[model samples]
Target: MSALVEVSELRTWFDARQGGKRCVVKAVDGVSFAIHRGETLGLVGESGCGKSTAGRTLMRFHNPNGGRILFDGNDITSGDIKPYRSRMQMVFQDPYSSLDPRLAIRDIVAEPLNIQQPKLPAAERDAVVVENMRLVGMNSEALSRFPHEFSGGQRQRISIARALTTNADFLILDEPVSALDVSIQAQIINMLMDIQERSGITYLFIAHDLSVVRHISQRVLVMYLGRGMESAGTDELYAHPLHPYTQALLSAVPTPDPKISRKKQRIVLEGDVPSPINPPSGCVFRTRCRYAESRCADSVPEMRDAGGGHFVACHRYE
Candidate 1:
């Protein structure tokens, strides 16, 4: 399948004042990836690692400082977003805050349609909203209610309905299930998978939860301090994580089977995540990486394919 979304050397920086001094936080530094026409690419990282920023940049929520963003083979970084807005959509992390409580469910879902399909008749737009709500397992009765009336999971379903109502082929799912209870999370994930199966939509699924990402992603990309640490096929990454950061992350996941969990040795990372405003040179992970050598402190490691399409950006892997 062709690449529905492609980003190359994408960078997003934030201006902040630290200790009364100004600095630039490289939230998404030189990240590159491709999402196929109908595949889920999981982007995993700790908080402040820029995974969310990358997703926002892809959706044009943030003005990209550098790199090229292409959706369906068109370079969007240089053009008017108004024309391409409907083709891409985002399901934000917090369902509670993402939706406006004042708007009725039908109007909330219909907002995108209003912006993108102004020429469509009111009846047609309402029909699209009703259809999308049904698609997300909500009924006509629920559409008349407000977001506050629904549970967290149902609110998220409403968010999904809003996104899908635009008939978007690409959806940026930014920690879509992180805020829900485990049971609710499972339901949402299952619902998402079902939606994908039925609609053939492509997803950029960003989250810190490895287990959830592993379950739904065809490919996985690990990020640290605003840069990609490792990327590989889902099974390949779980089977043999090459990057130290990736290894540590997978090690921390408790195996479902007690025997395997007991047998597994977890690699505990030390120190807090460094500030993106002044990320470490060489490898941003060197400060916490046990495998770091003198050379690791001298030069930034370039992402290279070790084998079997697995890529790692670490000096040790070189």
Candidate 2:
């Protein structure tokens, strides 16, 4: 299947003044990946690893400092994004803040339609809103209520409903379940998966939850300090992680089976994550990597295929 979205050497940096010195923070530095038409590509990493920045840049919510973003074979890195807005929608992480407090549920769900199809008749638009709300397991009764009347999960459902109003084929889900309760998270995940099965929608599921990613994604990409460390099929990467960072991350995931948990050896990484503004030389992960060698600091390792399309960027693999 052809890719619906392809990102090449994508970079998104920020300028800041620190102690009277202007510095640049490479939030998403030379990251690259592709999402096939109807699959979820999980982007996992620690907090402040530029996972959110990468998602926003893909949506053009943040202008990338460099690199290319192609949607359905068309370059969408720069230019008026209005034409692609309806085709590419985002479900942000925070449900409470994402919804407008002042707007009723009907208006909130219909906002995308209003922007994309301003001339659409009110009755027809209302029908579309009601349809999408129903798709997300909501009813017309909630339309008159404000955002404050709903719970976090309900608000997220509303957000999903709003995104679907555009009939979006691709969704950039930025931690859509992190803020919800555990039971609610499962419900939301199942709902999202069901939505995908029905609509054939593609997703870039960004989250730090390895377990959640394992459940929803067919492939997983591990990132560190604004760079991709590894990318492979979910089962392959989970069963046999190559990069040190990837190994450490998977080792930390809690296992429900006491027998397996006892047999598992956790790989605890040392030291705090380095600052993005002043990252380490060469490989960004070298500072905290247990297998770091002198060569790791001398030059960056290029992503190489180990076998079966499993790719890793580490000197050990080279």
Candidate 3:
């Protein structure tokens, strides 16, 4: 299938004021990737590793500092973004804050329609809203209720309904299940997959949870300190991670079997992530990497293909 979204050298920096000094926090720096039609590409990273920023940038919410955002093979790097808004949508991390508390579910879901297709008759728009609610497994009675009336998972479903109401082809799912209970998380995940299978919607699943991403994504991209560390087909990445960081990350995942669990060597990374304003020279992962050498500190390693669509960025790999 053809790419639905292609992001090349995407960068999003924030001008942060700290102690009267202005510094740029390179949230997403020089990232590049593509999401094919009807495919789920998982984005995994640490809390501050810019996974969320990358997702937001794709939606043009961050106003990218540099790079190209190609949607459906069209260069949308410079445009009003209004026309493309309907084609792409974001399911934010927090469903609680994502929806308006004062608005009923019907109004919440219909808001996107009002903005994208303002000329739709009230009855037609209401019909669409009710249909979308049902798509997310919500009932008509609940549509008249507010956000606070629902559980975390139900709220997320409502959020999904709102996003899908636009009939978007590409959806950015940012930690969509992180805040929910384990059972609820599974429900939401299954629901999301159901939607994709039915609508052929492409997804960029952003989260720090490796197991969840591994389960849902066809391909996975691992980020560290706002840079791409590794990317590969999901199965390949979990089986043989080329990048040291990727290996360490995978090692941290809990094994199901008791025999293997005790034998698995957990890679304990040392030191906290450096400030984004002044990231380490050369490989950003070098600071916490146990295998760092003089060569690693000399120059930034270029991301290169290891094998079979597995790309790694580390001097050791080179």
Candidate 4:
């Protein structure tokens, strides 16, 4: 199957001034991946690892500093995103902040239609809003309510409803469940999966929750300090993670089976993540990697395929 979205050597940077000097923070640097039509690709990393930035960049919410973005085989790197807005949508991380407090639920859900189809009749727009709300497990009865009346989970459902109002084929779900309760997270994840099955929508699921990623993603890409560390089929990556950073992350996920938990060895990484503005040369993870060698500091390790489509960026594999 062809990729629905392809990003090559993507980079998104931010300019800042520190100590009276200009500096560039490489929020996302040299990352590449593809999301097949109707498939979910999980992007996982620690906080500040640029997963969110990558998602925003893909949506053209942030202009890329370098590289290319292709949507359904058309280059959309530096063009007006208005044309693609309806086809691509995003569910932001914070449900509380994402929704407009001033708007009623009906208006919030119909806002996209108003923008994309300005001439759409009010009755038709309201029908679309109710339909989308039903798709996200919402009722039309809540249409007149304000955002403040809903709980975090309901607010998130509203966000999802709003994203689907335009019938987007691809969704950038930036930690959509991270802010909700553990039980609510499962509900939201299941709803998303159900929606995908019904609509054949593709998703770029970004989150730090390894277990959740493993549950929903067909493939997983691990990131650290704006660079990709490893990527492989979800089962393959979890079963045999090659990169030290990947290993450490997997180790931190708690297991339900006491026997397995007792037998598992956790890999603790030392030192904090290096500043993106002054990221170390060569391997960005070398500073905290236990298996780091002198040569690891010489240059960034090229992503190498170990076997069966599993790829890791670590000199040790070479």
Selected candidate, larger TM-score, 2 vs 3: 2
- Write one digit per residue (lDDT tens) for candidate 4, span 199-298: 9999999998588788889999999999999999999998898899998999999999999889999888677788899998899998898888889889
Worst 10 residues of 3 by lDDT: 266-275
RMSD of each: 1.0, 1.0, 1.1, 0.9
The local distance difference test score of model 4 is 0.93
List clashing residue pairs in candidate 3: none
Model 1, stretches more than 4 Å misplaced?
none
* lDDT of every predicted structure (CA atoms): 0.91, 0.93, 0.90, 0.93
How far residue 224's Cα lies from its native spot in candidate 4, in Å, is 0.7
Write down the worst ten-residue block by lDDT for model 4.
Answer: 266-275
Q: In model 2, which regions exceed 4 Å deviation?
A: none
Give candidate 1's error at residue 47 in angstroms: 0.5
Looking at model 3, residue 177 earns an lDDT score of 94
Q: How close to the true structure is residue 131 of candidate 4, measured as C-alpha lDDT?
A: 91
In the range 1-318, model 2's lDDT, one tens digit per residue, is 999999999999999888999999999999989999999999999889999999999889899999999999999999988889999999999999999999999999999889999999999999999999998899899999999999999999999999999899999999999999989999999999999999999999999858878889999999899999999999999999999999899899999999989999999978777899999999999989888889989999998899998999999978
> Tens digits of per-residue lDDT for model 1 on 26-48?
99999988889889999998888
Candidate 4's error at 63, in angstroms? 1.3
Name the lDDT value of residue 66 in candidate 3.
Answer: 93
